[model samples]
Target: MIRLLSIFVLCSFSLNAKSISSNDLRSLYSKGQAHWPAIQTSDGRRVEPMSLLPVASPKPEHVALGDKLFHDVQLSRNNTVSCATCHERDKGFHDGRTTAIGIDDQVGTRNTPAIFGIDQWQSFFWDGRASTAEQQALMPIANPIEMDLDPKIALARVNKDKSYHAFNKSAFNSSTLTTEQMAKALVAFERTLAAPSSRYKTFLTQLNKNPQHAINSLSDSELNGLHLFRTKAKCMTCHNGPLLSDNQFHGTGLHYYGRRFEDKGRYDATQNPEHIGQFRTPSLLGLMQTFPWMHNGLFDDLAGIVALYNHGGVRPRPRKSQLNDPHFPKTTDLLIKLNLTKQEQADLVAFLRIL
Candidate 1:
């Protein structure tokens, strides 16, 4: 009887241990299967993965030389500004402003986008005109509103520098300085400015191991906001994928300030009537830091942006350039109201802040 009782106790303990292990396995499997949320724009678009070109590390001599050149104002015509002036490290490599202020306090039309993950971008500029980072790097230096330097003249100036000459000989095995070489060095430096680690990235990693773990990691309000962003808010249409940019253009019917602002956006570059009032989508990573949103820096707050979308964007008029769908509901009273309470808006903003 003693032996039988001992056997029964051992059997019960084994069964309970097996059940606990099974529950753990199930939890991990469920967590791993959970899908990460994505964003969408009004135009029914999705974010595309950035295509990156493999870049070889610069020779130690070249990187050292490039670092000096990046900060040198002698490259500018007036010796008043350098790349560092606009792309300060503390501000996510973006000067905090509605638009970039450059040489002699010259104000530019477009906002200075962050340089992080620039190498991942296929096209540069708000217009998406420059196809390569190397090509895009030279524009600000030459732009009259920015560095205000002539490329040929800048190359000549660099050629005159004895330190540059020595570095060039050691790095490139040549003493010649060219506009192309200058652009290459700047591009190389910019490529290294990638931001990879974020809370979202951590979530992804945890999710792969166990989906419950991922969901558990996020705060309750963040999870709620994620549901709204993916479903009702419909932000996933454009702000999809890892980078949260569709790399496409859309007209959100923002008010432009210029008396006769003639900026045709993508239409100016592509000459496609469909592209009028359209501009490239920007990444939402580190968005909490880079503010005064949109291509024109029209909206100052995220709540305003969400409210605009909740209303289905501004109306299109004959003289007023519009980019949103004509068939889509305008922010007019005729459309069904989203009826999102103030707390919901705050929650949505909270989720975006996490991103």
Candidate 2:
């Protein structure tokens, strides 16, 4: 669950044979093998893994400045919050709270996501409001309930920091800085946050060469759960690829009439009725490290997540503005009444932890 993925592969494999339809590629995942799509491009061509993905020149100073800014409370108006306030590094970059609390103890509606694999996200936030990491980085700083630092003040603070100039000179060949450069610096630091190797990754590495060794690594229960995850559970339909996420939004069908507020999710950003109750699919990597899951952190553990899916998520809660709940079951297609036994659910949770 991570990347200072500096190596970049500029290849044309994506333009040729479709990687999505390859039976061999499909087989890699169907047999409980982990998703490492970088092994080949979309055209099924051999491509070297770019070990040094150059994010804005890949300078060491960028990472240093970004780390300082990441934990710097001075970025906040009240000096009480930073990006790390919600996504603390020790907590897998996620705050150990049901919902994030910001400056002045203003509570947010969603759980703080783990930033381990966050740089790879196609969009940022539960609602997909920001399209780039640089854009996403600057948002919470100016959010009234978050860091509460206005963009004008934030720009001035960065521009005025004399200490930042040394790194700025080294990075930009001049002793000056801009808010965009600071955001880029943060992005540079974040790109280094790569997924740490796990038992699953080790098993996956050996699966093609020594299937027996890979099969032997996991217990009977874990293997059984992997089978369920691939087929009956249909988790891979959305939670696919190396990140174990499709990087798209889907509805989870969790609504509560008893709540004092409503989070319309992607609908809030797009104003599209079809997107109601939808949120970005989060990566399954480092799942065990992030407790109290879901966009709202409604569940406490892996078991709760599996069980919720097993029963097809929450039933339609009673209505708020109207008389009854919306009759639409707008959740993902795979979310059905999966009649899984308790042990099967437990095994599924076990497999998730292994990832």
**Top candidate, metric TM-score:** 2
Q: How accurate is candidate 2 locally (lDDT)?
A: 0.66
The models' CA-based lDDT, in order, is 0.60, 0.66
Off by over 4 Å in 1: 1-30, 33-62, 196-198, 205-213, 255-262, 271-273, 316-343
TM-score of candidate 1 against the unseen true structure: 0.76
- The numbered model that scores best in lDDT is 2
**What value of lDDT does candidate 1 attain over all alpha carbons?**
0.60
| Steric overlap count per candidate | 15, 16
Native RMSD of candidate 1 (Å): 14.1
Question: Which 10-residue window in model 1 sums to the lowest lDDT?
Answer: 3-12
Q: After superposition, which runs of candidate 2 have C-alpha atoms over 4 Å from their true positions?
A: 1-57, 205-211, 317-329
Question: Mind giving the per-residue lDDT tens digits that candidate 1 earns over 1-355?
Answer: 0010000000001112122343343443344433332333334444443222234565676666667778889878799899888887777677778788998898887778877766557677878878898788778889999998888888888888887878788667778767787787777677666543356666656765666876676665666555555545555565655556655565544323123543556666787756665567677766766666666554556666555445445544533443343522122221223445566555566677666
- Candidate 1 at residue 39, lDDT? 33
The per-residue C-alpha lDDT of model 1 at residue 349 equals 66
